[model samples]
Target chain A: MIATRIIPRLDIKGPNLVKGIHLEGLRVLGKPEDFARYYYENGADELMFMDVVASLYERNSLQDIISRTAKELFIPLTVGGGIRNLDNIKSVLRAGADKVSINTAAIKNPDFIKKAASKFGSSTIVLAIEAIKQPDGKYFAYIDNGREYTGLEVVEWAKRGEELGAGEIVITSVDREGTGIGFDTELIKSVADAVSVPVIAHGGAGKLSDFEEVLKNDVSAVAISSILHYKAITQFQSQKDKLEEGNLEFLKSGKKYSKIEALTIQEIKTAIASKGILTRN
Target chain B: MTVNLKQVVIVDYELGNLFSVKHACNKVGLETILSFDKREIENASAIILPGVGAFGDAMDNLNKLDLAEPIKDFIATGKPFLGVCLGMQLLFEESEEFGAKKGLGIVPGVIKKFPKEFRNKKMRVPQIAWNQIEKPENVDWGTTALKGIKDKEFMYFIHSFYAQPIDRSDILTITNYNDFEYCSAIHNKNVSAMQFHPEKSGEIGLKIYDNFKNLIV
Candidate 1:
């Protein structure tokens, strides 16, 4: 049984995970490594460490924070921000990072995705598309934290991103981010329907039901940072046991081992061989 | 009844996606090694054969890397060999894509494409969407990953072709789109598989992987 994932995106400033409001005024929540492990331990499927300042920071912060997150954090970590050229990507990858995310730099030079794909392959490169839905219900691309408008249609840009070579697209509703209004499932369906690669639906996750609405589609993955950050929803609970008993397949498979009887990854195996889990469902 | 620790090595063929399975085992604190070495594969508690992408290329890569032999021998030992997607298809005798190429032949079937008629105009052939999962009534994953997601529940799927499994009992989970029920997972003593990318599926996905790792140990 393969699992769909829930990943937490941490915007890092230097060595710590920081959260900002509308791309301004920031506050330190916790260390990137600690928060990363916390999420992984708590039931986060994977992690995204956006070097929010990697592009803006005077120093790349490549070696220090990302390396720390990679070495200490464990679970797959995707690092992005200020990644302009291939050298930057190579530098971070060498530092134990699993994937590299690019935004402003990629928009400026579309060829970046192609080159990275050629080397690391499409699976390792995640293209972050920041979109703002206009008054007319059309989406226009926004860069630098929604300041500058690229005037590019969201769907067209997404297709080009896939053609240029990207493993996944994290299409975030800029207005919906951090609002807890629930994800824009319609927007996500359009983008996911338009491309073959994986799509990570971000922005506006108010509750588990919101997750249920988005999960209704076959997008690649879903990323919820604020909802998890604010403690709106708990990641993997005994829900699988309940789902299994409830006779629901989708709900049962994602039961994290962490939540199931405090077994290590290895013990989870032994537990299975012994038929410890009651087959009631 | 049970298996020992550190005896299994997940054969990393480097041709398809091994991250989800490998990462899941690692997360559950399982000490499984990821390798293409023959010695390691032959003497393991279990072997996870995971792959994605074109079948021809995958078989080509496995042959080029000289893994076909050891992989077959590994299955002969009957110590649990789990194939995912392309990896699962390789267990069959042959594949229909890019000409009739040979596969590992552990299972008795060939890989084929999906039928191109759908109730929804946009429901396309690749089966690329989250649909309901139909749990296998007979086979129970005792302490397994499928624990989280239940029947008629959804997981992510993205592929044009799929395996029409030779052994009906092997099919563990299926996803219903229109009139058809596509097999999403399979299990046959010492061998199991899932067409979906579980590692990428989030918490529920990890739970599934953790259960798979438990099977290995």
Candidate 2:
């Protein structure tokens, strides 16, 4: 089932979860724990923390955030960035966070994914990718926060991560992040089409309609910060419900909502054709 | 009023997250103690094994603390004992996922490596991420613990090579992929094992632990 996940992507720049695009360009926001707790209660499928530190902070402020988050929130948390070694992954996971996501580290050491998965579990590891749309229409996975191109194809790496035992693949469009231009549909479809593990689409969600569009492309989740960051989207809890009502297939949260099945690709297309779906503003 | 006896002892293997496991038991209105002491485990009514980490390291800690034999004897008494993921795998004879290490051998199986088969399958081993699951059959769904939950309900799962139960009757539920029909949950009288982390599986996961909490035979 396509589980509609509301994930708050927090950009951590020492102690505080800052937000920005590519590299060290981050603006200070509220404390990570406070933001995490808000999302936890309001309805978040899961949470992901992107460590903006170049993997070299004296004190692991991001870790401090994770430790704090672990105390207040009971939901699963995926901490990424600067996770170059097994020890980096272990520290946060041991602090009570559920999963540890690695991007550049996994690329530098393909063995990282395999080791972490075998040591921990595949579910506890996520391989983060940012694919840039080339002039040739092929998406190349970028690393080091989009500063350098890994020169590897998105589909190939996805297959590799799965082989390496990466439980899930979070594919973000580096070209689209914070641009709010809209998510890279063809790129997501390509990666999602390549691997069976769940795929999360990040970058360029300017409106709620964008979420619908991405889910329509068959991504397991639509991750947003800007739209929800402002009063533009009055509520986040209803995001999941809206997807359910629109006939998109999703995984159930179990306790809180009615056990309605999410719409799969065939179901979604059929619903659209049969006038059972609409573009709600 | 929870003036009742504490029916379960959530064994803290010291890898991580002991209280979360204990808290799940508490939500079910069952009394549970976080015990690292050998004395308390032997005296407790039931046992819970909760852990998260490397197989070899976890086994090392369990061995160093010298709590291994006591745990085995406690389970031998036929009281309800539940193991989550690494905790469950540790109940086996040996694990090949890492170099080569031994488990408690409480269950007559060796933790082998994830088959080269997954190398060609859609499922990535170290099966991280949440996925669909078939409803557990051995446990009664009528209990309030599984109140809103139904068959084929989805729960979070994270692991690589799943335990292949020697006794077919011991298999409780399963999830499938291209060529994988993983043994999701297992049970043998008073002993229950889950490949998924019930403590981290969100509410449905928490509910399973709650069911385990109320399971006072």
Candidate 3:
């Protein structure tokens, strides 16, 4: 049995790590490097750093953080957000990202996937699709963190992405995102069924069962943020003790943390294993 | 015997993630040099070809940098030569990635795409996940870099195509994905390559690199 990947997604806004519900209400968690190292130490199969505001900002601050993390972390690192052109892709890969996920940019220039995949390799390119369901129950691809819409449906878009040389497809549900309700398994299954490349199910994972439900489908990996991050805090009981000494002050005294019980990567793997799903232990 | 302190050199042909491989080697206390210079490769105790890109483009870069023949020459020296991912593919004779491209030809094999039958069914093309690898029938896992790693241990893989070695005996391990079992690792004399990325496979992965470090030492 193949080991399903349990990935920790760190959505970055400038230098700080931020999280939001439905891709809004941006809250800074801490430094990207700190969060990245924590996840790596805790058995995160892979790490995804999405620059949530790279399009709005003038400068991309993720390169330095990725470089620093790659120096220490051996697992594959994927950097997404604001990757628009060949030069952008080149610089990110050169900066030490094993793969680059293109969402808005690929939608804007569909041929960019082909060009990037050809120049670099299909394995190095991942298509990040943000899907939102419409009134008719049809899912359309959204861009810019689900703020905008492309008329194209997600399943069709994922197939096209694979045809265009994307090695993997990352399907993130905008409607279910940040809600911690659960994963949109239907959406995941639909896209995973449509594409031959590996599909990573992202957004709206709230519990252990959430992971199991999605993994039972064709999802190759799960891109989780809220559950993993919150779990890390609650499991440790306090941020002061859980976090490294240098970054202790990142969590302010008056700030409220998620009361939801957290689970570690090992715990999640064990839960998945109990369900008869094999994962890297 | 003058022991070489710097035991590994990750060849940089301007293609894949070279940093992580070097980082993995360093993590295991194996000194490495990320070099494109032919002389550096010739002088190193071992050479690691790590890449992720189109087969045609990678070959083009290696040819452009004139490191292609140097790589073959180094392999002939019988010092351990490890090929990772695309690097593993490049060790073969040719690839069907982009209209039939030639590889370094160190190993008698051809790089091929996963059939659409599996693609149309349960398995994905790239098979991008952590998958278990088992030793070839009647072969000890010790013969390859997978030494000390338990059987069926998971390693990270991210590729659509797999290698078909001309000699079945050259295959060190096989991984089952979908309805097919494909060669996951190849070992021939002092040359070895794996389709999986040990650098991205975590602690067990680092242990594999550590084993390779010891093999060369």
Kindly state the fnat score of candidate 3: 0.78
* Candidate number of the best DockQ: 3
The TM-scores, one per candidate, come to: 0.67, 0.73, 0.92
True contacts kept of each: 0.00, 0.21, 0.78
Per-residue lDDT over A157-245 for candidate 1, one digit per residue giving the tens place of the 0 to 100 score? 89998888787788888888766677888788889889866688888765545666776676656776655543312333332233212
| Preferred candidate (TM-score higher): 1 or 2 | 2
What is the Cα-based lDDT of residue B49 in candidate 2?
89
Tens-digit per-residue lDDT, A1-281, candidate 3: 57788889998877777788888877766667777887888888999999988966746889999999988888889999899999998899878899999999899999999999888878889999999999999999988889987899899899999999999999999998888888999999999888778889998887778888888787789998977776555333344443342323435453444433366788888999899887787
- In model 1, state the lDDT of residue A255: 32
Local distance difference test, candidate 3: 0.85
| Error at A68, model 3, angstroms | 1.4
Candidate 3 at residue B115, lDDT? 81
lDDT of 2 by residue, B1-217 (tens): 6465557888876675575676566666667777779988887788988877677888898889888988988888887788877788888778886577888887776665555445454443445445555654555545433445666665655565667667667666676643466676666667888776666656667778667766666
What candidate 3 gets wrong by more than 4 Å, as runs, is A234-261, B1-4
